[model samples]
Target: MYQKNPNLYLKNQVMSASPNKLIEMLLEGGIKNIRLGILALEKEQLVKASEYLLKAQDIVSELRYSINTEIDSEIPQQLIQLYDFMYSQLVIGNIDQDIKVLQEVQKLLTELLETWKEISVAG
Candidate 1:
């Protein structure tokens, strides 16, 4: 009997994912991190909150970097701006321990994730 390694399986899944799928995964990850950050904030766990928020910021940065400005200039540019705004808000939220800011970011991420899901289904 052969057992599959979870790490290897996940790597393969990511390697084989379509562009839209990858974006969806990133959005889901960002949303998860934001939710965790909000939870930490509510618990007054400043260090954990900062770590989670920073992780979410990093995910948004990855999303921004993955965008192809050459392919679709306007949309990618808009996404870049939106990601930048989210990153800034995450930074401020972490620094100030603001759950409200995290909530706003979470809402944006949820909407974007839903939109990406729709686009992926259509295309």
Candidate 2:
């Protein structure tokens, strides 16, 4: 069996990706993890849910911190706050094992992904 290293593949993709692509990747990752976390919470798998949610928190935190504040506008601050809320929700939902909280995060991430898709198409 020939197995490819997913980490190496992902690293190459990231190294070659444009800024927009990177953001899309992060959003997609966050959404995927949130979806997994939701399923884990629904099944009462607190440990697995916590693990997935923590990964989501990390991705969201990265997205939040990676925002370009140099672009003069209120958008950066707004995005920071949104990401902050999502990050906190991940924590709260993990501790409480709340499926709804995870679902909310999933919805937000999906919306972000949709916007990025549109941007990519228009750009």
Candidate 3:
């Protein structure tokens, strides 16, 4: 019984993914961790909630960092601002034990994910 390591599998997937696919993966991860954070907050698991929120913040940060600043489009600036807002909300949600803030970020990331899917499909 040779079972693959889940972490290794995920690493391989990321290493092989295209730039657009990587964005999709990060957005999905952000949503997943925020959902986990929300559940942890609901359960009163403050430390665990903090951990998940931190992971979500890291994912959002990575997504923001991946954007190209040299592009003359307003989209990159908007994305940077959005990621900045999401990161701050994550911090506030963790500190205040606020599930609503986490849910807001989750919804935003989910919408971004859907937009990415449409772009990939149309491209």
Q: Model 2: how large is the Cα RMSD against the reference?
A: 1.6
Query: Model 3: per-residue lDDT, tens digit, 6-86?
Result: 888788889999989989999999999999888888898889888998999899999989999999999999999999999
- Candidate 2, residues 28-67, lDDT tens digits: the string is 9999999888888778888888899999999999999999
Residue 12, model 2: Cα distance from true site in angstroms = 1.6
- For 1-123, candidate 1 gives per-residue lDDT tens digits of 114578787688799998888899899999999999998888988888888889999999999899888974589889989999999998888888888988999999999999999887887
User: Candidate 2 at residue 11, lDDT?
Assistant: 86
Off by over 4 Å in 1: 1-6
Tell me which of candidates 2 and 3 scores higher on lDDT.
Answer: 2
Checking candidate 1 for backbone clashes, the offending pairs are none
Clash pairs, model 2 backbone: none
TM-scores for the candidates:
0.89, 0.92, 0.94
| Superior by TM-score: candidate 1 or candidate 3 | 3
Candidate 1 colliding pairs, count = 0
Scanning candidate 2 in windows of ten residues, the lowest lDDT window is 1-10
Give the C-alpha miss distance for residue 119 in model 1, angstroms: 0.7
